[model samples]
Target: MHLYYEVSGNGKPVVLLHSGGADLRDWTYVVPFLANHYQVVAFDGRGAGNSPSPTEPANYVADLLALLDHLEIGQAAIVGHSMGGRIATDFALEHPDRVSELVVVGPALSGFNFSQEFQEWMQRINAAFPDIDKVIERSFDAPSYRIIKSSPHWELMIDMFRHHLKKTTEWGTFESVWPEPPAIDRLGDMQVRTMLLIGDEELPDNIRTAECFRDIPDFQSITIPGADHMVTLTHPNELCRHMIRFLGG
Candidate 1:
């Protein structure tokens, strides 16, 4: 099934990928700014947002490639956040010729071992069984939501989560999207122009994950202060500035 996607403007192809539980709406704050100079596309990956439910675990890298093919975009830059970041990295690694530039925000690697703090936090969550809203606030909203607590966008984000939260657990877990021979192990071989963005206040695991790519040639990593995992929503202008520069806008 075709994914639910939005395309705007008419320039170089630039695709926006969202985080684990988020759909394309994750890019709402950044899309118009980018559309001014890019053929910006945002889509709901399988089982997220308005996309069709998955029959089994998805090969998201391939799915993304197919999406591009469907759009007749032979080559394009990719901008992804969290789970989307993981997919973007995987795609660049798997199909280097198709990517012009890569941007990953708060990426999680396929084989990345969770930081000790994250593992402990998961254990705590299981023990306490916090409500879904509480879970999102802890895992996604925390440091960032506090920065935009009074805004309508914050409430919109929360509502989006409430709507998509059902499928997250039902579709697949961590092991679903993970293919053997993870991305972290093959970083040395990938030379795609890459820019990494991480929120300084995000979970320790994510901060640790982004650090792994720092030494790769042609790779750039930036940190946004007072932000959390969902930096696109929390700090759109700052992210757009960095992305526009890297994208040569």
Candidate 2:
């Protein structure tokens, strides 16, 4: 696969799909714990981290399949955060047999209409594009990041956001292709065991998204106290503990 990826530990494969505005570094805290129990495959999605900029409209789902095929991973537990969670949900719906389990952390769901407030917030950031500093400032000002902004990992988060914003300037197109009819419309079709993990202090849009996933059969949801959107960074131990228990480690 053209995407850059790293594999660690050894056991049933588990793939990590990071949130937008960051890279595989989003898993920096969570990986060490999960790696000790299962083989962890974390990669930079197109146009993020070490991955090449998209020359055409990006197809994240196809890129994921290519990664699995390249690693010869027949099936894996798919774990995703934010935008990554949206991708994971679509992937499981499109290729159910390839996903042994599905876990979405503060996921964004396709076909779920985002609140105007959230859309406007994103627009403000986009308007500051090219001026990386302003964009970064606006991005972190969201209620979703209230906790992380004061956490020790704030610098790391800023670094990733800065890096991703810089890289976006090199992209040919910002469009990303997902499975048809949207994952939100296909939740009932998901066959893999699923889990939804979120922080108590999340944006309304994300909380609404989580509600959509609740209707899925055999689904479980957990809320991490004292965490916001960046639960992976602030509560890695707790996140890993819940994940391991759910995955039956």
Candidate 3:
């Protein structure tokens, strides 16, 4: 359960969780800025980076809980991206009082409605070459996706992608990881203050997902202009500023 991680600064703790197929290194750009005001801890999720892979998808939650237990962190803010966000939502819901606050970026929780355009976009992404190398290359070379490519953390992003793809078995990814249930309904019970972050240019469904939690008394959301789904990498400073404000650093 000793997942690879990096921590810096000295203040109230803030844990950063990477997205699917990404590692603790993915937050290289954002963590330093956040570290200025708050202690920042970034770690790879189970099955990614240096974390051990589990046979069942649900074990990820256990892995996260074990991590928290190991760290002896009683209460802390959590900033999670994509798959990490889903795990964060679950953690907050199950252990409501442990989270001081929650920040979710590009969260992919299920059960939200999707428009036709958004559906088509999902299809396109799914249809994209399943090869991680090609996907990483396309992600960088695409003109519209240049924002992330320009980030100081871009090299780490690419390296993380390469590492996951190399460590993952073809069947393990398809069978053990993909096609798992999501944490959409469980979010409503999350009692901690939660801020959902997404990019202005992101797909409509992603935006809608953020909107879905707007009515929750503790839920809020914000969108960054000129940013894509990879907002943390593309606008790390801005993202850190918002997180600092939300986390009351």
Candidate 4:
């Protein structure tokens, strides 16, 4: 299935990919800012938003490459968050020439061991509720609920998660989808210019993920103090500013 994507502004191509639960809208605030300097293209991944879900993760990566081929973009800078970050790494690793620069936000690891604690945590989420509303509520709240409790996006976040929950049956959703965390070995050889962005308030593992790519020649990292996993939504301006500076806008 063709993924739904939007293009904004005009200039060098810059691609934006959203996290797992959310769609391209996650980049709403930042896309316009980046569009000022680059042609920003944001798309929803398979199983999220308008994109069709596939049981395989590699298929999703192929879908992204096909999208670029369709767009006739020889190369473009990529900015991905969470699951999108993982996808970005995979894409660059497989197609080194198509990527201009890579920026990963709160990037999830690849092929790394799933800690027993994290596995138990997943089990807890799996056991939460069969009801989509209850499960979405719990999944969304598991991260930034306390800090964004007063933010306007709290309702939007809940709504989005609930909508995603309904689209995929609760029984099959969690069971079918669990990303293989990134292996530190593969990241060491990532040839692209890479930037890892994380929030101080995000999970400890997320904070440490940036350090895993020390083998990449141009790897760099930055952290936002009060922001959490959903920092892109909370600190859109700051994120856009950093990206602009890094991409030499």
lDDT of each: 0.82, 0.93, 0.73, 0.76
Model 1, runs deviating above 4 Å: 126-152, 169-175
* Per-model C-alpha RMSD: 2.4, 0.8, 3.4, 2.8
Alpha-carbon runs more than 4 Å astray in model 3:
56-58, 112-146, 150-154, 170-182
lDDT of 4 at 85: 88
Least well predicted 10-residue stretch by lDDT in candidate 2: 176-185
User: Which scores higher on lDDT, 3 or 4?
Assistant: 4
**lDDT string, candidate 1, 1-249, tens digits:** 379999998899999999876788889899989999999999998888888767776779888989999999999999989989999988888898999999999988877898676687667655544487567656543354465565557776776677677766666443356555888888878879999998777766777788887755799889898777777887899999999999986
Please state the error at residue 115 of candidate 3 in Å.
6.4
Give the number of colliding residue pairs in candidate 2. Answer: 0
lDDT of 2 by residue, 1-249 (tens): 789999999998999999999999999999999999999999999999999999899999999999999999999999999999999999999999999999999998889998899999989988997788898889888788999999999999999988988898899998878778988878887798999999999989889999999778889999999999999999999999999998867
Candidate 2, residue 232: how far the Cα is off, in Å: 0.8
Tell how far residue 196 is off in model 1, in angstroms: 0.8
Model 1 vs. true fold: TM? 0.90
Question: Distance (Å) between predicted and true CA of 246, model 3?
Answer: 1.2
- The digit string of per-residue lDDT tens for model 4 on 1-249 reads 377889999998999989877888788678878888899999977777777655543355677789899899999998899878878887888788999999999887566565676677667677887866656655655554455556766676666666666656522333233324344657766789988887877755665666676667788888877787877778888898888888886
Order the candidates by lDDT, highest first: 2, 1, 4, 3
What clash count goes with each model?
0, 0, 0, 8
- For candidate 2, the per-residue lDDT at 140 reads 81
User: Considering every candidate listed, which one attains the maximal TM-score?
Assistant: 2
Where model 4 places Cα greater than 4 Å from the true spot, the runs are 55-58, 141-145, 170-183
Q: Pick the candidate with the highest lDDT.
A: 2
